[model samples]
Target: MVAQLRIYTINRGMMASWLQLFYEHIRPLHERLGMPVQNAWVNAERTEFIWVRSFNDREEIEAKEAAYFASPERTALGDQPTRHIAKIEVRVMEEVPATAGVS
Candidate 1:
């Protein structure tokens, strides 16, 4: 499985607004598109939002993400959510298999 990690730097004082939009709108769209978010977190200072998603393969990732961005639902939301983001960092990661007897 391939994992995608996204870290978004929220604009100052916009954490609540961003989270509301994400949980209420963006996340639902992701789920409907078969790209449910696995987990999410916020930095202590609330300046950053971190989330992860898993896909069966790189092609699925690319296709689903493209569809998501191009979706009519996402288009309607427009910049309402993104305007609160100051910066973003995205990483595609893989899990390392556990080694036997290696705690």
Candidate 2:
């Protein structure tokens, strides 16, 4: 499986508002699109919001994300969600396949 580690740098003093939007709207929308958020975290300083999403493969990520960004539901959210984001960093990772002789 492939996993994407998403880290968002929330605007200063907007962590609470961003988290509200994420839980109430962003995460729910992703779930409806078959892109479940595996887990999430916030730095102690509250400047960074981190989350992970797993997919069957890289192509699945591309397809689902394309639909996600193009969804009318996402459009309806307008700038409410994005306004709090100051920066975004994404890292794609894949699980190491087991070898036949390896335990």
Summarize candidate 2's per-residue lDDT along 1-103 as a digit string, tens digits.
8999999999999999999999999999999999989999998485999999888899899899999999998999999888999899999999887885697
Error of 2 at 95 (Å): 1.4
List model 1 lDDT by residue over 1-103, tens digit each: 7899999999999898989999999999999999979999999485999999888877799899899999999999988877999999999997766784687
TM-scores of the candidates in the order shown: 0.90, 0.90
Cα distance off (Å), candidate 1, residue 27:
0.4
Ten contiguous residues minimizing lDDT sum, candidate 2 = 94-103
Report the C-alpha displacement of residue 80, candidate 2, in angstroms.
1.5
- Evaluate residue 53 in candidate 2 and report its C-alpha lDDT on the 0 to 100 scale: 86
Candidate 1 has its poorest 10 consecutive residues by lDDT at 94-103
